[model samples]
Target chain A: MTGPWAEALPWVIALPLVGAALTPAVAVRRPRAAGFWAWGVLLVTAVLAAGLVSELLARGPFSYELGGWPAAYGIELRFDHFSAWVLPLALLFVVIVPFSWRYLDHVMPDERRPPFYALLLLNAGGMIGFCVTGDLFNLFVFTEVVSLSSYALVAVGGRGLAAFAALKYLFIGAVSSLLMLFATAQLFVLTGSLNMAEVSLRLAEVGGGTAVMVAFAAYAVSFMVKAAMFPVHVWLPDAHAIAPSPVSAVLSGMVVKVGIVGMLRVYQIYYGAEVLELGAFNLALVWLGAVSIVMGAFFAIFQDDIKLMLAYSTISNIGYIVLGLGLASPYAVIGASVHVFNHALIKATLFLAAGSIIHQTGFRTLSDLRGVARAMPQTSAAMAIGAVSIVGLPPTAGFVCKWYIALGAFEANQAPFGFALVFGALFIFIYYIRMLNAFYFQKPVHAAVAQASETPWSMRGPVVLLASLCLILGVLGGIPLTFVEPAVLDLLPLWGP
Target chain B: MLLFGLDLDYVAVVMLFCVGLYMLVAKSNLLKKLLGLNVMETAVFAFIVTAGMVEGGDPPIMVAGTSAPFASPIPHAMVLTGIVVAVSVTAVALALIVQIHAHFGTIEIDELKELP
Candidate 1:
């Protein structure tokens, strides 16, 4: 059973695709059952993902030819350690969607919910497929699946700004998708194969041609827009700030990271070390990253709205990953990969905790949040731990990422980037201190204690699970690093020691 | 007549692409913008189909009556999916714009920013 079924990598992606295909009918028949159906589908996908990982470990780098065609002509699904690990992380977030169902029901009225959870699960499946696949054109197809669902998810929550933010997302997504398609078209013209491995070999031969460079540029810039890199990062704060809390959780945690993975993959495979050995690409990314770090922090400082502030801080946090990628050392790549994994956990915890706060008190301003710690110590505690981690205190997941990233910058012979890491640490302190002051240290001007007990179990449970993961991943750091090191090693070149 | 056997779908596709992109960017009406996006997507679908076409190729579908040789179906497979996705995206974006109009009382991008 295991041997024959193990060959089926597409099942991991197909489960959600089929679920999305069936969603509208499910909602129309029994709207109440939609949440249950969504949960069941996502859980199946999660188990399938776990099973997929086990197979990959046993067999090593599983690839399945679509419709029984060979690699060159067929769309293939490949799951390496790198791609497989994102499975559980993505699955974990998908689990949070159903938990959000009851929570959202408490918030959003009945008229608002029919297709919502169905879309969420579909989007999750699409995100997982995007990460797991080896075909370049297939990757764009999965991207559109996720992107289209996201527009509706963002807009459906009934915030006036949510609609407009989704609109802005529409403009950007359309242009970026076109850019990616153009790049994909170029690759198709050049290699006549959609498979990544074959494309890599062909790309190496066609190395640094004008057409290839244009394709690389198009791919890079488009993915950067998705990753919300600075300058183009203008769309992020609004999208994050106004989107439903659960949706925000996914966007900040998983969606943006997928786009980063695309950039990193293409940079390594398509551009290679020789092109980067000349230092043009990394120079651009490093400067862009530094600017995002400083600028995102500065922007975060000024936001009065707490969600908006966190959104800006997310922009700053993503900067660390970009910086690590730009540094392009072994440790830097480790730092970047681990940072992606770590950011998902810590940021998910923070956003979910923030969601609980917004859900309970109906307040979005930091100043209005005095005495939240006493009022809701559970949530306050989670926020404190996540915030402290963001400031890069050791024995937390954030420390592992910052430690490697800062060291990676130094490894690249850039001491100033190391300093930039330290400065980033300091700014994290300043802001979280203010937030903590509002939450724990301040007097309760309104006596909001009785109203502020722990939130519903659904909200508290997911937030706790993620926050606990932050601590566990920090202490048991070597476990994930084992998986990540091999993956990152493949991406990087042998630098002069 | 035998000087050169060439087809000219590229010209039409390129022109349609330009016209669609211009309408999308320049139009103030949300519905029209959605139309533009659809037009652009169709134009792209045309290009993909053209790229896969051979001079005397059939529709690349199997039939019991005739196993006629046909153009590559790979691009067609991708384009079919693209068309469905394009429509899905258009539906979502149009829905968003409809809601935007309800709230801000205008479909114009310039006017909406004036809202507090």
Candidate 2:
């Protein structure tokens, strides 16, 4: 299956990284050029990603060995169905970079644009590497790249408060990353190999034991922190809310998925090895996921700051994906996987819309921004669409995935969890409904909000496009299923729990 | 030298990890907390380096002095990379701490929390 597209694998990861390094140099004469430079780099990367996905479809999975070194000895990059995620991931970056061009004018001085765009490119490249790498050590390294860039991005916007939040995020994030590194080393000591496929084979030979179980536990905790699930999610709200809007959209929409993807990778290895009993762990995930859904919504109801509310809602959406994954039924896993993509689209719509409102009126709380819909109809409309989609209402992107997950709860005979899903949705609906009411029904409290105009076309275009995607994906929900189904089915036979 | 049926080196690593975790959780000073994170990184790095040891093996170099039973070179490479990552993380953390101090005029978590 080695085709011309296969040859392009390493370049997909390389282009953004190299582009990031070159950003400051490229923008030394004109800082504004950094944004366009980033957009062009990401646009090329997206084309290559599309080519790789097409190759995957035509020839199944393919691998590229770095320096022509064989697998299990040297580094390898594999393009399987799961790696198809890079396509949507790159496309999201392409959309986001354009929005950030004008968006940064309000967030930072012109001189700062170069480093900001550089960090964004670093983040995108790191995530692309994280998705496609076939080595455990490389996974840890890429996780750091993503995590380090995110810490910088969170603090790149404002003063003291943003720094405080970014520092808090860094402390927790660093610890989780250490756990991941520890787990990788543990596996390496046990198997003498860092390649994921080879580790699975060697793990099967080693059989189930305390050491393997401990490593699995470490990986689980590490990724859960990354995903910002419930108790360990303390770092998320402040970091996501305080970041500049485009950074907020990126962090809230995509960065947290690092944890979920890491979890799927761990599952692939352990399930392939057929080692240890995962039943109790799965139950724990189910309960924690349910609690996260409720708790996230419960907190969101009280937040007056609109960005903070959106950040809390992210915890709730992540809960849905986690719950679906925990169910372990084919339908559930497929739903969970597709939700990873859909939630990103919907959240980007909401955050960019919210950012536009903040950019125009400089008001963040719902009460301060009443009647905003009257002044800025299109942005508010996009926000409304995003809100509906997030609440899992019909004919929106969020509906299809949540419905499949609900059906999966039934299929798995977990009727209680199925009910929990609905209850959580109702809780989510209440808060978004509050937002809509504030936008459309309430009278204005501030003149700035009442007279606010629509954002410039650069920002508004992405918001409108992403919001339309929320609805379009709803009608054509089957598309992502085509990519996720085969991958889930391949792992299902050994998915004991 | 064994402690509680485990190698003494392993026991030392566990103790170091716990000490670092305690500082991270119990201390209110941000710099101390960061130092604690560094301690934790060192403990993990020590564990990986120890894992690659061969009791009586030569260094993993390929010159005339090195021979069979060479210590695994992969873990060394991994730790080297890990150290580079740790340094970068520390650099970022310190930069953030500087910003926090500049803005809030304090590096203590408790004081930062009390401010409006």
Candidate 3:
């Protein structure tokens, strides 16, 4: 627990943040250097994250106290099985930043690249910090860091509509963040501690009450907004779709996971305390999750814009995770956790591939992009792989976790929701089938699309690599379960009545 | 002070929070919505500061005369951090608003929606 790997924990979060601050300065003389600089930063962070995960495997969960302070008093950074997410999260950024280098030629001028990369790195650091922190207040701070940077990143593409979308995102996002801060303060007021473990212990001593329930409700609503669950999902589509494609991949793939991760942190606290009956709440989540699934895919079926469809699909995927969590069975929870990782891979592949096509043909709508597969065959093939994977076909990454979640639905004796899950997947499959048909079978409506050339290798490389990983991980899907199962087992005992 | 058996300060905070929410939802002006957000933040900060107050307690400063009943300093620290965050959010919101103004020539949600 006290080895070099343990020592690397703080540096994993700090490196990206420091690198982000240094980006503009480092690239001041040569603005193009910012992209390479950000990539290098994330590369090292991914390495550190891998080392930390290895340490977790060798040992169990470990903790690090900031400034030599003890656990109850000092801010603690704990890396349990759940925190293993940082490794993939950082690796996704490593892949994404490179794609953005050439992608930015269409997004903004060279001078804007530094700030764009900086915001992206800030976002990475914030999420990494979010996943690792063991203090409630620290969680709020990191959420703001991520939220603030995300708002700017959405508008960073430079358009009036982009600014408007970013503003709407800011209003809703800032409110959710305020709710999170209020919840944190409420917990602190009730327990007189900000450390999550300490707060849980104190809450156990205090037992359940209206105040505690209110705090939990606040956290729940806040996270649901962040996750873009059905009711509060209005802000997500525009903000996600309007952002540049690389930003879309990051936002859709990773940023939204913050809510799910934060929810897990709250569950760790409340479940550990054995406070408030969560049965009714779980039922509500199951119902809402089902609705989100249908609604997300239902709306996506109507969208012509590829990125907007992908954005809606994110809501549906989040629904699957929420439903799995609500099922409260071990299989369901494990599936949901692994889906968190797999969906990121699948979505990033789709977005990057879509970005490449758009970059080549200057087309975004499916009707306008017909027969694009003829011109950019590799990118289209990658997009097809992504589409198949997202629809939960066998031997693809999305299938594994979703199959487990379906089993979990039946295991939890929720036969109806299991059916719902299947139907949701069918709905998802229909839209993707439409997408594939447009890409491969149709004649090009726009001459520009017909004459479009393939993207540079810089962009095509990431798309192909991610698409291959989609298949590779589909076959090797059990890898993430090794990290997820123990974590869910640790949680399920106190889950509910 | 107590209002209907609840602390008046808390009642005030809740009322202020509702007022801000109303402005954020009901008002169309983007700037007004931003101000409303700041007001809501202030209310939450006030609630935290109020939670830290001790009955007739001295400031949480340790020189020689500090006693056991000193006000909790942690809430102050939290509020200070919260204020800094609020300021940054406000700054970002304002910047976005400026861009919207430039692009659409309107900051009212109603007018903006009518354009294309």
Candidate 4:
């Protein structure tokens, strides 16, 4: 149980917060150094996350109590296959840091840039803490940290529209936070403890009651807003679309996924044992996921702004994650979990590459950016890989998850949802095809695209690395599937039994 | 009169929450919406604090030789944390409201929506 890696877990959250605290002073002296400083801290974080995963690989799931206190008495941070999301999250921040450097120069004023880096680091710290913590109150605290930083990050764009978007995002996000906090309070009232494992044990004794059901509903609805699920997703498109590109990438790629992580943790805590009959709720998830998929895809097809389209596509992809979990089968859960990893990879690549194109050409819409593929082959190729993977094409990581989820839908005897999953992909394919056609086949509609060239390596490197991982993960599907399978089995033992 | 043996405190919390949510949806003034949000958060915090209360309990602090029922300290601690979070949110929302006012010259949500 003891090893060198034992102490590294807390640092994964600490380094980013420490860096955030240090950023402004460094920024005052050398504003540009803030990005580099943030970059260096995040690299260490990525390494630590990878180290922890290797430790987990050797020795299953483990929990670390804060301040050397017992779990029931103090906060405990659990690291399971699910929370190992810190690895992907850290990798995302590492990619985003370099991408932000030159992109911010154009979009953010010099005086504002330092705070931007600080906020970015804070946001990353919050997300990493959110992923790793097992205490419900700790989760709420981290969620606020992430939400508040993100709201500011959006307004940092300083566009009139961006300011308005940030305000709307603030209200919606704050209300979601309130809902989740209330739910946490309800669980506290029922269980007399806030530790997730302890709460689960107590809930088993208290049994499902009207209050517990109300709490579950509150958690589900609030997380639905946070995850930007279809109906409650009004704030996401504008907020993501108007933010500077790297922020958009992080918001789309990582932040919304935190809601999914929270939702999964709730399931792990309350629904893990078959003592409570949750068939109705799982059925509700399947339908909600199905509708979001179709609805999100339909909305994406109409958006002309490249980032807006990507943002809408995110809602649809979140549907896939929820759908997989709803099926409640091992294959489905694995598919859903792996999709979390794959979607983050693909979406982040697409957003970064899109940002680079916008930075280079000053064009954001399809028609204006036509023939971009001919000018910037590498960026276009990365986008194409991401697009192809997102459409659930074979030989790509996206396909691996969708395949399992679709298979799980059938195995769960829910063929209509399986059809919805595939049909949703087809709907998504139409828009991606539209984008690809505009990128490759159409002639440049403006001088920007005609004169466009490849982005510098600082911006290019992260997108290319992520694009390549899409293929590598697809080909080496076992790498993630192995990490995913056991986690699913541990959470849902009755699956396929 | 007995109120169906229900916790009246919880009923009041729910009523406040619904009223706050209604203000958020029904009103369009940016400041009022922020107020509504505050009200909602206050309701949640109140609920947590009330949940920790014992019918005739003493304060949660321990004394040298006393043995009386005491309110749970955890929920009170959580309420303190929630209050800080609530204040931060309110400050940010007010700042954003000022920006919106300066830019649009109005804080009414309806009027703001009419801007280009």
Q: Model 2's CAPRI class?
A: high
Candidate 4 local lDDT, A54-107, one digit each (tens)? 888888778888999998989998888888889888988998899888888889
Model 3 segments more than 4 A misplaced: none
By TM-score, is 1 or 4 better?
A: 4
TM-score of chain B of 2: 0.95
Docking quality level of the chain pair in candidate 4: medium
Chain A TM-score from candidate 4: 0.98
The lDDT, on a scale of 0 to 1, for candidate 1 is: 0.78
CAPRI category for model 3: high
Cα RMSD (angstroms) for every candidate in the order listed:
3.5, 0.7, 0.7, 1.5
- Per-residue accuracy of model 2 over A187-288 as CA lDDT, tens digit each: 999999999999999999999999999999999999999999998999999999999989988999899999999999999999999888898898888888
What is the per-residue lDDT of model 2 for residues B1-116, given as tens digits with 9 covering 90 to 100?
Answer: 68789999989998999999999999999999999999999999999999999888888778976778988888999999999999999999999999988888999999999999
What TM-score goes with each of the models? Answer: 0.91, 0.99, 0.99, 0.98
Clashing pairs in 4: none
User: Could you tell me how far off, in angstroms, the CA of residue A254 lies in candidate 3 after the best superposition?
Assistant: 0.4
lDDT string for model 3 (B23-48, tens) is: 99999999999999999999999999
CA lDDT of every candidate: 0.78, 0.94, 0.94, 0.89
TM-score of chain A of each: 0.95, 0.99, 0.99, 0.98
Clashing pairs in 2: none
- Cα lDDT of model 4 overall? 0.89
